[model samples]
Target: MYGFEIEGGFTFYKFRDFDGSLSLSDDHLKWFWEKMGKAGQISVVFYDGSVESFEDFKKLAKLKDQHFFLGFKDGRPAGMFWLNGFTQRSCFVHLTIIPDFHGKAALQMGRGVLRHLLSVTDVSGSYILDCVKGLIPVMNSLACRMAQRSGFEKAGVIQKAVYLAAEDKSVDAAIFCAVRNNEVKVSE
Candidate 1:
């Protein structure tokens, strides 16, 4: 039962004490989706399909075969992370925070979520995080730096085609992979 409270308890909490198979009802998922849609500050990067749709949420939720929900805050879905491709010894983390919760203070919350996720899982050998290129530049930088600081090395980048909002058609998306020190744990 590890958790941290911030802002004198105004409206943010980071929790990490549950297994990967955490569940949420349909109502909460829909509510958070609607809130994210309306919030101009929030932008979902992996938008190839109807990510905000309940079907997508259900898919991601049940993906606990190698993932888990970190927890929620202020009744809004805070963040969800998972480890994909277990045999590949890789874990991918996705974060969706309600716009109202995005700020300098939220960095700790994000770090806490990552730390908690990394701490709980065996990790097999290495972890891979696929995120939008330079998305939320400051935060992304922080996350990368944090991952490195936590003893993960930047393996390299894998470019994949994806649609860019600024562009009409799909383009190469840089996927960054960071690996822990042990090579036996992750495959090249």
Candidate 2:
């Protein structure tokens, strides 16, 4: 089990049985992709208007700028959390929770991951996440709401920020962000 105490002395735990293991190794890359594909959920859309295949996803995950983690629940693949375009100031967070673990469980796991990111990593600026408005409900809406509950606030909307293959068009995205210091206001 892994754990950390966030602000206010609240401790969060990522158990091997409940929250599963999180790792950046290639050993679980394929397994993670398989689980994501099976969920019929596409967490990200490339700029080229193509959804990444398992191979391409693995390659992208292996990139130096990206941090990928696969979570296993009860010794099986359960969820994934990724940080793309990481820099000293900020990064984009992408999360996917298999349908089987959707709802409250997914929200708990997501909060745990976000708390870990904020408290454990060297990321002291901000953490941002974008989600296509239309897909929010179907694609883990609870997790999106949990972000706000965890101190992230809605920043703004980006028109045509993502290409949805299923719809064959670009869609508006809702941007949310959490800043490390309360003094730094999110720009309008």
lDDT string for model 2 (1-188, tens) is 44444332233333222223343345567776667667766544333334467768766765566556666666576666666655555677766766776666665566566656654532564343322111222233554465565445777667776566666777776677765545222121
TM-score of each: 0.56, 0.66
Model 2 error, position 109 (Å): 1.3
Clashing pairs in 2: none
Looking at model 1, residue 41 earns an lDDT score of: 25
Query: RMSD of candidate 2 to the true fold?
Result: 7.7
Native-vs-model 2 lDDT?
Answer: 0.55
Q: What's model 1's overall lDDT?
A: 0.44
lDDT tens readout by residue for model 1, 1-188: 43434332323222222454234455655665566667632334344443545577557645545343434665555544434545443455555555565553355455454444444433574333322112222224644454443334455443444554433445443343433333312211
Off by over 4 Å in 2: 1-27, 43-49, 121-143, 149-151, 183-188
